[model samples]
Target: MPIVKNLVTQMSGQIQVESQLGKGTTFTVELPFQSAEQEEHPCGGTLDNPVSLEGKHILLAEDNAVNMEIATEFLTMNGMKVTQAWDGQEAVECFATSLPYTFDAILMDMQMPKLDGCTAARQIRALSRSDAATVPIIAVTANAFAEDMAATTAAGMDAHISKPIDFAALCCTLGRLIGKSSKN
Candidate 1:
């Protein structure tokens, strides 16, 4: 007889597998549902002074040093903790090796050395871990167009923000994903 068991996590159901006699065996685990702790947005209302992004952790992947510096300063000033990668490859590597659920959101640059944002995002979505796949990835690129938006969305990004990033827009995007409203 083959021994069997069931397990569940915070965003899915139980996954099971079996083995054969004198052979190898395997199993699958389903993730449980994630708890939505925050309340739904009240559409178009000036969010109660907007939500403060204080202490939130953000991962920024941009190959440009100047842009990275500017973004880092902006996010830090708003009380967010920022971790940066110089290119898309680094971003994928970081995400793959992170200490489980370590990121609140990711700001991905479309063009980079080694790997572009699209490929990196697709890889991230295919990760074996649930959180890795579910974490919000927001594309930050200079390509502002309808086609660009469609491409990014198809590549697994949760949202898209054009470059020369607008401070207000960035705040709004962050708020929507993490369940906060613009504080500024």
Candidate 2:
């Protein structure tokens, strides 16, 4: 429920939920419409050429199954390999156990059931591995405030991405962080 609401709001839409005892709930979503004149300035421009993340391996830590699937599909479409971690603890464990430099980057979520993105990042940074201090850990979260970014930075994350995820921005961030060549 929270994930759905967050994604909707992030896309500049409103969602309302109504429920009654012994009855199913109904969710109403209101999204802004752009007029023909305004259509020229669509939020994010359409991709004439999509960025390729070939040969990149990403560790994605997300609690929501739907969100995880969406992200994984997007990344995969861009030619990147994605590894899933359901929570912060699993992320930490995955990073700790993997070989040094195994993953090119990590996409972390701030809120999770066990541990948290911040704690996981700290733990990964603290690991005794060659890439522990250098691997780019990017926060993919719903926390979009200045303090949230500061917190992610303090936890050793290299970048912060707010949800709902913007594919173009995500591609650019990943490219900049990992020094990938532009596809177009």
Candidate 3:
């Protein structure tokens, strides 16, 4: 909630609240954004030559259903095959059971039920498979603190993408990481 409020305020937006005493409270946040036609703006790159995320197999680990659905939709739309894992434990197990080198990369949410992403990443790195240390494991989370990033690195994550995710950055990062992995 703090993060949401901060983001809204930073974007010169307003948050409205409606409270009914015996009922519940509703909050509405409105943020300003450039239209699709707006070019040469922040977040980088043009829409016409957008980063290609095609033909890569990605393992996505997110506990939130709505977040998972949104991520899956965008990833699939960009031609990447996604394997969903509802939690960090499931993510670890999914990777463990997968054939080595099957996943080009992993998008792992930091906070989750059962095991957290850091632990899951560590476990994945500890595996004996040939790709265990080679595959890119990207930490996707709301924890953008410096310490949080350090923790992910300590746990064997190759990169970090703070939420709410920047789609352009995500795509470029995936492309760069996967491309690098394929070379090795």
Q: Best candidate, TM-score-wise?
A: 3
Kindly report which residue pairs in candidate 3 clash with one another: none
Cα lDDT of model 3 by residue, 1-184, tens digit: 7656665775679999999999999999888877677654233566666656788899999999878987898899989999999999999999999999999999999999999999999999999999999899999998999999999999999999988777667887888898888899
lDDT of 2 by residue, 86-166 (tens): 999999999898988889899999999898999999999999878888888999997999999999999999899988897
lDDT of 1 by residue, 77-179 (tens): 9999999999988998998899867888899999999999999999888889857767889999989899999999999998998877766678878878876
The residue ranges of model 3 lying beyond 4 angstroms of the native Cα positions read 1-49
Cα error, residue 171 of model 1, in Å, equals 0.8
Clash list (residue pairs), candidate 2: none
Name the runs in model 1 displaced over 4 angstroms.
1-48, 180-184
Instruction: For candidate 1, give the lDDT.
Output: 0.80
Model 3 weakest lDDT span, ten residues long:
39-48
The count of residue-pair clashes in candidate 2 stands at: 0
Task: Give the C-alpha miss distance for residue 35 in model 3, angstroms.
Answer: 9.8
For candidate 3, give the lDDT of residue 178: 87
Model-by-model lDDT, in order?
0.80, 0.86, 0.89
Q: Where does candidate 2 stray beyond 4 Å?
A: 1-51, 180-184
Q: How well does candidate 1 match the true structure in TM-score terms?
A: 0.71
Q: Report each candidate's C-alpha RMSD, comma-separated, in the order given.
A: 19.1, 5.2, 3.9
